[model samples]
Target: MARTAVPPKKTIVKKMNYLTGFLLGFGLLLSGCNKDDDGVTKPDGPDPNAANLDVQDFMYKAMNLWYFWQGEVDILADDAFATDAEYTDFLEANPNPETFYFDVLLFSDDRFSFLSEDYKELTQNLSGISQNNGMEFGLVAFSNSDDIFGYVRYIIPNSDASTKNIERGDIFIGVDGVTLTRNNYTELLFGDNATYTLTMANITDGQISANGEEVTLTKEEGFQENPVFITKTFDVSGTKIGYLMYNGFTNEFDEQLNEAFGQLKADGATELVIDFRYNGGGSVNSSRLLSSMIYGTNTNELYIRQRWNDKIQAAFSPSDLEDYFAATTGSGTPINTLNLSRVYVLTTSSTASASELVINGLDPYINVIQVGTTTRGKNEFSLTMVDDPNRQGAPYIYTPSRENNINPDNSWAIQPLVGRNENSVGFSDYTGGFAPEIELQEDLENLGVLGELDEPLLARAIQEITGAGAKFDFTVEMPAEAFTSSKMFSPLKDNMVLDKDFYLPEIQ
Candidate 1:
């Protein structure tokens, strides 16, 4: 049989109402069963042995109805590939149909939307669960050559790396006796291995020399990450500056965030420095709660405005657009709202999504001095869809009723781009990422320490705080070879999530 596929042309369904049938994350019922010759009810569930065409059909229908940029996509008209045959044909004809289908519908050049067959794994990933050796390293080239070097960025507490005494700033020149060159770094260092040897190196007088030590690390399974990487306070010139090395916005660590802030509050710290250099982003609600902790006065003010596609927008009232976090967390306890007039955020190209949201969202109310490099520039968010019978606990309320067509085997769920987030005073135009007010690169040649006042990034922020100015030159020469492969590390999953906020329905 010819597989279902995307039709070559647009095919708008005149009878279809996206608002009533599929406004939120409801399954589409495009092709229902008809009455049999004997007038008996026929089974409408998709065949378990069939070509699996329903999955592709569901993708098209959901994106067409609720995708944030549905109108801008020319080929994604309503019911463009609504049938099983068309979707199946399209799939069979294209080797990478999933990528091709999703890519054509994205009008904003979004790269975050994805499909996962196992939502249980996705849930675990979102909760900061992963299997790995726990070695976060950054690669650098030696004076414009392919000879790359790596330095341990940080160690997860109690992980294999930490247990093995693989401290931050420990340099490695080779992997398993093989030098990490630009040509083979990705393959040699990032490939899956149960155990490997790290050939250590050292930096002295602006040169990298081998330390002649081979440290073997065995990979472990189910290592949960703690987002509160490091927290410390520094006293500089009679000024108390609190520094935090926050890695991601995982909600499981909300109490940890509070504890860190509580210490800062008790220590009489007047200045704050948040290092988001390695943070890609995670929960949106966590971002909001963090913002609330920073400046508590904006309880009634708009934190962000969610704008949906036209059809979905029509379903919401005007008041539904303005959203704000409470002065407290979901636990009903008051947060440590600092009421600070200024905040310093240390960022890099990896800083993105919810991280940028906090920066952009807090800009109108306080001084957000961005230090380091530009962010990853993602303002979109997504919600995870599960194959649940009750449809409870979804990001949005799934009110549409489905009659007897439940498929227990629907293990697949998609995290599609659902909406764009803009802050109060209506400013979210950082498509190319927010440029740093004071630019400085990580001094790998002299990586002083992780959370100390001497850490290059933290030192710069302190200099700015102490009125010395954000003027710091790179100790290493210009345009060094910089490579990143931490994303390839095991157990570090889904750092690019902004998953909590959704364009909600009125619930009438």
Candidate 2:
């Protein structure tokens, strides 16, 4: 029999309806429970006045809304008869929602318990100290110009210790052996349930001494910086390839990236590798900035499209495009551009949110050859915030007040908007993630460190860029085991590979 030619398969974008179906189906699976003999619903309300009630209610409402927005009806079955546990579990699945809710719940519960046990402990300790000396015992605000100058906000006074000996304006230099810096203050003093002998010095005398102290402080929870680590680079034949290790986007991240790229470019880097192995996410704007620099001057859509619900309906209109364009292009001012037209990105299961945006956005305009593993399919975006009730003197919590879809069309393009969706112009079909143009085996041994220039993948990229059969091969041999741990790989890993064959056509 004669062999028949198979036509090239057409790319299909994911539709909004399909995503709605998946979310609904998953939610229903989560809500499922073993049926009873009676086949009747059982009462499933929590105990009256239990603190968990508020959490339960919020979870149920949020999960239902999320499901509804996604158009998942199977999971939206009449909520009137739903159990509290089921609802809570549904909300828990949302990215980091449980952390916000549970942390507050746990802290509130434990705080009251501590207060009850040690209600008069401070008073008792201060009274004893005052009786032994000729000084008043009270807590004083350690401030400069009414703003907290140091991490030690409150201090107990001792009479025998003397007001003159330890004045209100005393600067706290250290606690225990740890130097008092703004970064580690809360972690060292309060977060860890450790007793600290605070070292302080009077503003007037500048005499530093360790005061006999035994007080418990609770560390207020705060967000920490997520840094991108670049490991090492080697020559792939004649092409100098560099690897950049990055996890998430941050406000001050542009400077860090600019410096790294500047060095790489100066060192004769012809091709670059970006590793997003365990990156979660950060600002969408940061992703745009990075994408802009990599792709150079081009009109590239960073996302397929964005969706707006009734709450943020204004965001869905075309008028918002001007703002989006301005934010992306940097306020009409001429911007410095990187001439590099493409980049190789290493992705894994942990790559999500803004990371996805960067990949999806640039795949259309440049060569974003994804290596390693498939990325976490999290195309949705949300604005997050936290409110300090004490400082604001009111309840403040980061709430997702508005929802916006990144794509120009309000419907899902990765899947499809609806019905039979057409293949998007200039966009690749990346339902889960863009597949590697050249698949390469991951070497577990040289995991966290950058691979040698002679590695098969890097060699291919060099061959493509510098033409085949280059005279020099910049290959370095390193230990394989060094690549396993995330910490050990600062920015680059030894076994890291970029699928080099992936390339876009040069503009004619």
Give me the candidate number with maximum TM-score. 1
Candidate 2, overall lDDT? 0.37
TM-score of each: 0.79, 0.44
Candidate 1 wrongly placed segments (more than 4 Å): 1-52, 79-95, 117-123, 140-148, 179-192, 203-209, 318-321, 385-413, 469-482, 487-508
Q: Scored by CA lDDT, what does every candidate get?
A: 0.65, 0.37
Could you tell me the lDDT of residue 102 within candidate 2? 32
TM accuracy, model 1: 0.79
Q: How accurate is candidate 1 locally (lDDT)?
A: 0.65
Each model's number of backbone clashes? 13, 33
